[model samples]
Target: MNSMTRIPLTQLDAREPKSSGPQQARLPSAADVPRARDTQFKDTHGRRFSYLRLSITDVCNFRCNYCLPDGYQCSDKTEPLTLEEIRQLAKTFAAHGTRKIRITGGEPVLRQDLPEIIATLKQTPGIETVALTTNGYKINQHIDNWKAAGLDQLNVSIDSLDPQVFQTITGHNRLHEILTGLDRALELGLSRVKVNAVLLKGHNGDQLNRFLDWVKTTPITLRFIELMETGQNPDYFAKNHLSGESIKQQLLANGWQQKIRSKDAGPAQEFDHPDYQGSIGLIMPYSNDFCSSCNRLRISALGKLHLCLFGEQGYDLRHLMKENKQTELESAIRHLLQDKKASHFLHDGNTGAIQHFAQIGG
Candidate 1:
């Protein structure tokens, strides 16, 4: 495959094995399944997984240009996993050496029982971190309850520092409200707080200095994620996708020191500055060796296990999430790990079944 060549979705689909029955058919026999070394989850590529991104819902209020620009449209009528199912899955992951669990959604706060969900994960054994990723639509109203539920970290999406630009990008003029909520979250002493922004070529691309200035005084990590090409919106992606390397180079030249990534950390490459109170992180998925340190697995709101965000397909795990299926669920998860690809084929323009970020809580 050449750098400029893109594999068509039809051709990609033809290359994958067609499944007529349930996804469970792909699972290996219990006797044939290889146990992870040290009882921790290790894939065929030697990557040890200890982090899980669990999406509780696919509903969102924002219409961000990069993700759900047309706003959230419910295509899958399947009910999201119940609270008990989420707890069971969290417990199973934790028992397998998973230390961190990030709760995500189209907007997790939309779930009225989110605080309870946080409390459930926090109470799970072997889990050390319970984080929430939200658009900050209701953080100001629910931060107190969320913090009291033992939420350890919070990541809010704030694409642009300028109010006008923010509204233009998200179709919402609540930046003031969201920023105020962040301040309240900080005041409550959350262990970690971060702001996420997608790097768009023309929209917020030139606002790097504005973002840097805000982070200079705020004690929060601001991450700029490179726009990725998905199944849908190839035209929009081509027009707006910007590389994170440019911003990284700027930070390095300005004396911002790159921090060593922790084993269980997310993909972002963090950078710190002596004079700034906060730091910067760059998530460049298209970069070389981006998936070498893969440590997390994604579970969609409907309980499908996605090995990679850009993988060809997801495996159905909801059927094995029954109360008495803990052992079976663990076995299924372990068996499925063997099928995880060494790396996603995003560089080849293969976005798998992901039409947008909201589908899998990107």
Candidate 2:
């Protein structure tokens, strides 16, 4: 989208190693580097947690067909957590081994005080990254201010490049606004601007080539995510379930090669096209086994800790925070982390206890 030179993927090494070559092991010279000994969050399965997805709010502007059915209404019975509460939770999380945090919402940009919130998260010690996931409607308006507030990365949800199709899926005619946000973000030096698209059959599923064409025109990575069986949209999931493997197969047939996997990429399995500098990523939560190495926890807008995305139950941290039980809250947090389940039950085609993505700040 920006008028910058695009590097052909063929020109870059597809199997390029992270390092030039294996060097002699050296001892740490700086005390700033975190040691494994100091790592705090680990489960009985020995999976160490380092990532936190903090949902700031449960209100979203778009009524995506899959995320929220038409005419769906969110309850206003519970007040959303305040900024001071978020600051305290972030500090507690950082002190207990959280390295990266992603601030999410129904649409995080809806929060007018987002810039201040980003600044607060950035100021927390031991938190190396503070990112946001938004629909990109309001991001363009505050991108500059957010960047100034120490925002590091962004994940924008754009399912289709076609305006009509995008509108049909998201129930909004704001594709241009998202594109503008993407362009502004690229121009603003956000090195990792990821375009996240949930793959749904017969709904933007035919736009793979268009997506590829657009990716080649920009410097952002395109991530194709498999539609999970969020309970709220069981009928949609049952009717339009497209596996990430099929997407990868389609890309492979188009001359894309599976990227090397020496480094951990969390959920997505990345692939590189020989002709395009930008790569494609596939997140197969249901079709592929991805929970073995999972190292993240999610916090809802209500301050509940969810060890698994499909977790039917969650521990309420808000009650502790409201009761001013700081020490008990810390202990409860640790206990929840330690007792986290080994994996989610989505593999069994069950949506579990949660179905509303908006409720979890999805």
Best by TM-score: 1
Candidate 1 lDDT (Cα, 0 to 1): 0.85
Residue 109 in model 2: shift from native, Å? 1.3
Encode model 1's per-residue lDDT on 119-233: one tens digit a residue.
9999999999999999999789999999999999999999998899999899999999999999999999999999999999989989999998998999999999999998778
Off by over 4 Å in 2: 1-38, 262-264, 322-326
lDDT on C-alpha atoms for all candidate structures: 0.85, 0.76
State candidate 1's TM-score.
0.93
Distance from true location, Cα of 115 in model 1, Å: 0.6
Candidate 2: Cα lDDT at 168: 90
Can you list the residue pairs that collide in candidate 1? none
lDDT: worst 10-residue window of model 2: 1-10
lDDT of 2 by residue, 1-362 (tens): 00112222222221221222222222122232323565477778977778899988878888898887663476554666688888888887888788899999777888888999999999999999999998888777889999999999999999988999899989999999879988899999985899999998979878888999887868788999888887678788889988888888888888999887644348778888767868899989875468876878888877777777776344456755543655555666665554466677776666655667776765
